[model samples]
Target chain A: MRFAATVEVQLRPGIADPEGATIDKAIAALGIAGVSEVRAGRCFRFTVEAEDLASAEEVADSLGERLLSNPVIERHLTTIEALG
Target chain B: MSMRVAVVTFPGTNCEHDAIQGLEAVGAEAVFWWHTETSLDGIDAVVLPGGFAHGDYLRPGAIARFSPVMAAVADFAAQGGPVVGICNGFQVLTEAGLLPGALQKNAQLTFACQPCGLEVAQTSSVLTRGLEIGQHLEIPINHFSGSYVCDEATLASLEANDQVVLRYRQNPNGSVANIAGICNVAGNVVGLMPHPERAISPLLGSSDGLHLLGSLVSSLPAHR
Candidate 1:
C-alpha cells in the first residue's frame, strides 16, 4: 500500500521564533489589524510504501522523529492517509 | 611526528579548505575525509568546517548529520578523540547529538559577518586546553542561524559541568548566556559559531584563532 504523509515541524513553545516575529512585524506594518502573533514552520509531504496504513503511519512518525525534526528545539505533527 | 587531523567535508561544505590550511598552519598534517567514508583510521582528531551543508535544507546541518562520516565521527568522539565543529559544523554536531543544544536563526533576523570578541570560559576542552579563564580572543563569525538554544535544564548542567567553552564579549546573535562555544561533558568534543579557520592569518585581521587551534594540536597525545 502507498500512503501519503504530511509532517509539520515547528519550534517548541517558548523557543524564540525570529523569522516568525519578523513576519509578524511586517504584518503590523502592512496595516493589518488584530494579527498579533505569528509562528514559522516547515511542512514536508512525501509518500511511503508500507504493508498497511498502520505501518505507513509508523514510517511517517519515525521520519518526523528522526529526520524531519530536531527534538532539541522542534516538534513535529505527522498526518498519514491511504493512497490508491 | 605531526598530528594528522581529518577535516570532513559534506556536499555544500565550503570551508574545508580553510580548515585544512588552518590546521596545517598550526603544524598538524590535515587530510580531507569525504562524507561518504565511515572510517577514522589513523586520524588523530576531526574538524567539521563551516558552510551550508546539504544546502541548509531542512535546517542547517539537519540532513548532513546522517552522512556516513558522522558515524565514524561519533565513534571517534566516543573514544575521547578531539572533535571540533565550527559554524555550520557546529549545527551538525548538535544535530548528531555529539553536542547539546541547537542553533536557531539570529535573534536580529540578520546574517552576522564580522570579527567578534570571545572570552574563554573553560580551559579543559580540546579547543581551549591551555587558555586562561576570561582570556579574550578575536575571531570572525559569519552566519544567520548562529543563536545557540537549549532547555533550561541543559543550560544549568552545561554551566555546572564546565562545558561552556566560550562566551561572546558582546552578544552578536542573542545566544543564551552569550554562549559562543561549548564542549561535551567529556570535554573532548567542541562546537562553536566563530570561524577560527578564517582568523588564522594576521592578514585577515587577527591570528588569535591560532591560540585555539594550537591548543588542540598540543593536547593530542605525543606521537609514539
Candidate 2:
C-alpha cells in the first residue's frame, strides 16, 4: 500500500513578500538561479493508502486537480511514500 | 442632463435592483447592465451590487472578474469614473486586481449579516466625497469572506496613500486592521464589505447611509 499527497506554492494575493524577492536576488547574484522571482506558497500532505503506486498516484493527481489546489492560482507537485 | 449610472448584474447577482434603488434614491438615473454586455456607454458611474455570483464558486469573484461587463468597468475606472462595489461586488473588485487585499473566510467561521458601524477613513474617494474624515456611519454587512487580509508592506503603503475608505468601529470579522472598506490609489473605485444599499433609508432604522450615497452625487453628471 502507498500513501501520498500533493503540495502547492503560490503567493497570497495583495501581500508583498520582500523575503521571496530577496532570496531570488541572492540566488541570481550567485549566477545559479534560473528563476527571476520566487513566491512562497503552501503544501498539503494527506494519506491515501492504496494497493499500488499507480493507484496512489491516480488518487493524488485527481485530488490535486479537484480539491487540494485551485488550478487558476496554484501549482502542484506530488510524491508518494509508504506509511508505516 | 440626468446623472446616469449603471448597475451590473452577473449570473447570480441578486442585488442589482437594490443597488439601482439606492442610486435612484440619491437622484441618479440608474439602469441595469448585464455581465454579458461589455460596455457601459453613456453612463457617468457604475455600481456592482452584491449577491452570490456563480454561487460563490471557485473563490468569490474569481470567475466574475473577467466577465465581459468588467471590461467596461475597468475602462470606466481608468477614466476616473466612480465605481462602487458593495459586498460580493467588493469581492469581484479584489479578484479583478482593481483593489488590493483579499477577503478571507471569517475567523469565527460564520456568515455574518447585521448592521455594522464604520468610520470614514478616507474622504477623498469619489465614493466618500463630501464626507468628513473620521466620521462614523452604520452600514449592514452580510458575508462569510468578509475578513480582510494583506501583507504588512502593502497594508502600510495603502495607509500611506490614504486608500482605506472605511474602518469598522468594532472588529467584526477578524479583518486586518478592522478594514471594512477601501479605495484604489486613484480613489475612483471603492470596495467595501458592508452593503450601503441596505442602509440608505430612515425606514431601515439608520439614514446615516444616505450621507455616503449623497457623496456620490458630488459633481456627478445630471440624470439621463
Candidate 3:
C-alpha cells in the first residue's frame, strides 16, 4: 500500500519567533488591523510505500523525530493517509 | 611534526580556505577534508569552518550534519580530540547533537555581520585554554541564524559545568544570556558563532581571534 504523509514542524511554545514577529509587523504596516499575531513553521509532504497506513504513519513519525524536526526546539506533527 | 588540523568542507562551505590559511598562520598544518569522508586518520584536531553548508537549506546546518564525515567527527570528539566549530559549523555541531542548544534567526530578523566583543567565560575549554576568564576579544560574526537558544535547565547545567566559554559583551543577535559560545561537558568540543579564522591577521581587521584559535592549538596533546 502507498500512503501520503504530511509533516508539520513548528518551534516550541515560548521560543521567540523573530521571523513570525516580523511578518506580523508587516501585516500591521499594511493596515491589516485586528490581526493579533502570526507564527511561522514548515510543512513537508511525501509519499511512502508501506504495508499499511499504520506502518506508514510509523515511518513518518520516525522520520519526523530523526530528521524533519529538531527535538530540542521544534515539535513535529505527522499525518498519514491512504493513497488510492 | 606539526599538528594536523582537518578543516572539513561541505559542499557549500566557503571558509575552508580561510580556515586553512589561518591555521597555517598559527603554525599548525591544516588540510581540507571532504564531507563524505568517513574517518579522519592522522588528523590531530578538527575545525569545521564557516559558510552556508548545503546552502543553509532546510535550516542552517540541518542537512550538513547528516554528511558521512559527521560520524567520524562525532567519533573523533568522543575520544577527546579537540574540535572547534565556528559560525555555521557551530550550527552543524548543535544539529548533529554533539552540542546542546540551537541557533535561531537573529531577533531582528536581519543578517548581522560585524566585529563584536566577547568575554571569556571559561578558562579550561580546549578553545580557551590559553585565555583568562573575563579577558575580552573582538571577533566577527556573520549570519542570520546566530541567536542562540536553549532550555533553562540546559543553561543552568552549562553555567554549573563552566561550559559557557564565551559571552557577547554587547549582544548583537539577542542570544539568551548573550551566549556567544559553549562547549560539551568534556570541553573537547566547542561551538561558537564568531569567526576566529577571519580575525586572525591584523590586516584583516582585528587579530583578537588568534588568541582563541591559538589557545585551541595549545590544548592539543604534544605527541599527537
Candidate 4:
C-alpha cells in the first residue's frame, strides 16, 4: 500500500519558542487585535510504501521520533492517509 | 610524544582549520578525519569543531549525527578516549546521543557573535581538567540556536555528578542554570557552545582558550 504522511514538529510546551514569539509580536504590529499565542513549527510530507495503513502510520511515527524531531526539546505528531 | 587529536569534519563544517591550529598551538598534533571514515586508527582524542553541518538542515547537527564517523567516535569515547564538541559540534553530540540535553533557538531569536564570559564549573572533565573552579575565561560564542535545555531530573543528576563543566557568567543564550558546557558522566565526553579556537591569541583579544585546550592535551593518556 502507498500512504502519504505529514509530520508536524513543534517545541515541547514550557520550552522557549523565540521564533514564535517574534511572529506574535509582528502580528500585533500589523494592527491586529485578539491574536495571541502564535507558535511556529515545521511540517514534513512524504510518501511511504507499506503493507497496510497501520504499517504506514508506524513508519511515519518512527521517522518523526528518530529523524524528524529531537525528543529532548521537540515533539511530533504524524498523520497518514492512504493514497488511492 | 604529543597527543594525536582527530578533528572530524562533516559537510558544511567550517571550523576544522581553526581547531587544528588551536590544538597545534597547544602542542597537540591535529589531523583531519572526514565524516565518511569509519575507523579512528591510532587517534588518541577527537574534536568536533563548530559549523553548520549539513547546512543545519532539519535542525543543527541532526543530519550530521548519522555520518559514519560518529560510530567510530562513539566507540572511541566508550573506551574512555577524550571527545570534545564545540558549538555546532556540541549540537551534534546531543543529537548523536553521546551527550545529554539539546540546544534550542536563542531566547531572543537573534544570532549572537560576541566574546562571552564563562566560569569553570568543574575540573574533572577532559576540557577543564587544568582549570580551577570558579575561574572565568573569555570565549566567543557564535550561533542562532545555542540555548541549552534538559529535563529537571537530568539537570539534578548532572549537578550531582559534577558533569557541568562550564557556566556562563552572564547567561548569554538563556541556557538553564547558565550552563555553557557539560561533560558526560564518565568525564570523557564534553560539549560546549563557546568557540575556544577563536580566542587562542592575545591579538585575538584573549588567550584564555589555551587553558582549556592545554588541559585536554595534558589529560590524554600516555599509551594511546
The candidate scoring highest on TM-score is: 4
Residues A1-81, candidate 2, lDDT per residue (tens digit)? 757556554544544444466667778898995687576566778888888877897888786665554443344677777
> Per-model i-RMS in Å?
0.6, 9.9, 0.8, 0.4
Q: Provide TM-scores for the models.
A: 0.97, 0.75, 0.97, 0.99
Model 2 residue B187 distance off true place after TM-score fit, in angstroms: 0.5
**Model 2 pairs in collision:** B1-B222, B2-B222, B2-B223, B2-B224, B3-B222, B3-B223
Over 4 Å off in model 2, which ranges?
A: A1-84, B221-224
TM-score of 1: 0.97
Ordered by lDDT, highest first, the candidates read: 4, 1, 3, 2
- Local error of candidate 4 at B87, Å? 0.2
Q: How well is each residue in A1-84 modelled by candidate 4, as lDDT tens digits?
A: 899999999989998999999999999999999999888999999999999999999999999999999999999999999999
Candidate 4 lDDT, B1-224, residue by residue in tens: 88999999999999999999999999999999999999898898999999999999999999999999999989888889999999999999999999999999999888989999999999999999999999999999999989999999999999999999999999888899999999999898999999999999999998999999999999966235
DockQ of 3: 0.84
Error of 2 at B148 (Å): 0.8
Query: DockQ for each candidate?
Result: 0.89, 0.04, 0.84, 0.95
C-alpha lDDT values of all predictions: 0.93, 0.80, 0.92, 0.94
Candidate 4: what is its chain A TM-score? Answer: 0.98
CA shift of A56, model 2, Å: 20
Each candidate's fnat = 0.90, 0.00, 0.75, 0.95
| Among all candidates shown, the one with the greatest lDDT | 4
- RMSD in angstroms, candidate 2? 11.5
Better of 2 and 3 by TM-score: 3
Which portions of model 1 miss their true places by more than 4 Å? B222-224
Evaluated on CA atoms against the true complex, candidate 2 attains a DockQ of 0.04
